[model samples]
Target: MPVELTIHQPSEIFLNDAAVKVKAESPAGCFTLLPRHIDMATALVPGILSYETPEGREVFVALIGGILVKQGNSVTVATQMAVEGPLGDLKNAVDVMIREEDDRDRKTRAAVARLEADFVRRFMEFRKNA
Candidate 1:
């Protein structure tokens, strides 16, 4: 029997299909899930997630980060972001995504710092006025 695979993102369902095999990367390393695999759950890192369909065609998904659960003949993945495409394209996409995420983080930090500084300045002015 084929394993029912479902991938979910915060905004929408990324994929729902039947897979003969599923491969993903976790903190420990990469692993493949096959039929009759032991039930388990793991935290997935930002990497490529691939699965072989029953017809033996491979599909790839670029994942930012996620949680995966396998039970019986069902596997579910919940990720913050996911993009499905060819293996080569997905690899490059993941690299770009990482860089974009880092840039966003830096900008967010700077904005927070500016907000804190403004708040402190306002508080000091209020004390002086009082």
Candidate 2:
């Protein structure tokens, strides 16, 4: 069975006439919903959400914040925010986001490492004094 999907956001709206299923990001992790997916909802986060149908994956809303999937043969995504652009534009945006995320993660790890080192040094000094 094929599923119908409609994607809407503040700036754009996209619809998929023949959708198989959708894979989107959630607070917990990546969630995939097919025609048999039980009705459920999840918190939205910055991530990639992709939709696929019998004709193949729909490229319109490949990147979205989050999605709400309904049970049955038809699936409707209710949301308030999304980033929409052409195929090329979307591709570029995704690349940029990936790069930025990698950079952010690296910085966060480095900061934690530095903080841990400082704490360890302080503890060593206090132990020596005692």
Best by lDDT: 1
Q: Residue 72, candidate 2: how far off, in angstroms?
A: 1.9
TM-scores of the candidates are 0.86, 0.55
Q: Give the per-residue Cα lDDT of candidate 2 at 128.
A: 100
Cα deviation at 20, candidate 2, in Å, is: 1.0
Against the unseen true structure, what C-alpha lDDT does each candidate score? 0.94, 0.68
Quality of model 2 by C-alpha lDDT: 0.68
Give a tens-digit lDDT track for model 2, residues 7-56: 76656665546678677777887777888777776665565567776978
Residue-level lDDT for 59 in candidate 2: 51
In angstroms, give how far residue 82 of model 2 lies from its true place: 3.1
Write the residue-wise lDDT of candidate 1 on 22-107 in tens digits: 99999999999997899999999989999999999999999987999999999999998888998888989899878887898999
